[model samples]
Target: MFLVTDPPEPPATDAFVLEPLRPDLIDLDTEAYLTSPDVIREHSCGRWPVVGFGREDNLPLVIRHWSDHQARRAFTYLFLDPEGTSSLGCLYVQPLFPYLESMGADAQTLLRYAGGATARVSYWLRQDSGPELAASVAERVDEWLRTSWPLDSYLYRATPEEEFTVSSLDRLPLDRVVIDLPAEPHSYLWWSAQVRGGTTRMVS
Candidate 1:
């Protein structure tokens, strides 16, 4: 339910919309984002819930997480079809501190704020959707974020060595920025374009 000032051109499937998750929506979210071990691993960097935990335990956690999102602690969204009945994908948007800390960066690295607010962003969509939809979702959501959030720069992490990832990130106009984080497993790229008043263009 973000207030998009200037929405980007609609995706090929314009029926999709981004919606915030709630307790009642837990089953749908779980089914779409955490259906199986392989699905969880692919989307969550190989981290899954504790062993023996069932949906009963998972539901309450999702409720609490949604509460945190409402409190601005963290943000997560579900990409829903036009009918708003099914989830097509998931997106996570959070500040850079937790990400850096999780990567085992030093305190200074975690504390440093470059430029304006830096938001760490990532997404996971169904492979059946094909590359076009993936790129479309990223672009549309990236534009919405730039307009709706207090962000001046975006930090995107992916294994650039992978051809698919490189193509996906290029859709967002994110270019590689040099940095070293021995503990991190992937390359981090920063968007080198300026997003102002709904338009994005190369800076410098």
Candidate 2:
């Protein structure tokens, strides 16, 4: 497990700022989620933002994140515009153990190329932010992770547009895996599994 006695503060740049996700920002968070395209949401979050996901739907998640942050178990940050008036996206930083566990992959095998990295970092930008701004954000975050954080290495999961082979010592490439699930035939999960070429069993 990753443990930090004092987690570093969120990073900021001229293009955007990172702040811990909190209750008061639920409205902005909801708006960000609602405005983001389905593809972007799935790429960033690993699942679709369910239909009609609003402030009410986001409250419990924010609360859970707050608790996790306080416990130093994980960290979730909201990307905000320069003036901090709007949510642009989100960042997630957490230990790699849980991720490997969920994937049912051998830790030793996956960490072979991790270069002693203990944490996994992932982020996404608002689709409407435009390619130029998205590129800037990704570049800035990459620098911040290398310079500001205490960890020397990290497993970086990037969106399709940002994905690249990692040749650097500070970052490691994340290998993708397909998982099979049991879902009722014709259900959304079953459809998703089919599209991803994953096997899904019909639920009685």
After the best TM-score superposition of candidate 2, give how far the Cα of residue 55 lies from its true spot, in angstroms.
0.8
Candidate 1 stretches greater than 4 Å from native: 1-15, 34-39, 49-54, 106-116, 159-166, 185-204
Q: Itemize residue pairs with steric clashes in candidate 1.
A: 15-82
| Worst window of 10 by summed lDDT in candidate 1 | 1-10
Give the per-residue lDDT of model 2 (tens digit) for 1-204: 556445777777888889988888888777887787663545544465657677788899999987887787888889999899999988887775555555544545344323323567766667577655666665676666656666644555544433321222123222233223223121111010111123432222
Tell me the lDDT of model 2 at 136. Answer: 64
RMSD of 1: 5.5
The number of clashing residue pairs in each candidate reads 1, 0
- Give the 10-residue window scoring lowest on summed lDDT in candidate 2: 186-195
Best model per lDDT = 2
- Cα lDDT, model 2, residue 143: 64
TM-score of 1: 0.72
Per-candidate local distance difference test: 0.59, 0.60
User: Given candidate 1, what's the lDDT at residue 124?
Assistant: 68
TM-score of 2: 0.72
**For all the candidates, what are their Cα RMSDs to the real structure?**
5.5, 9.7
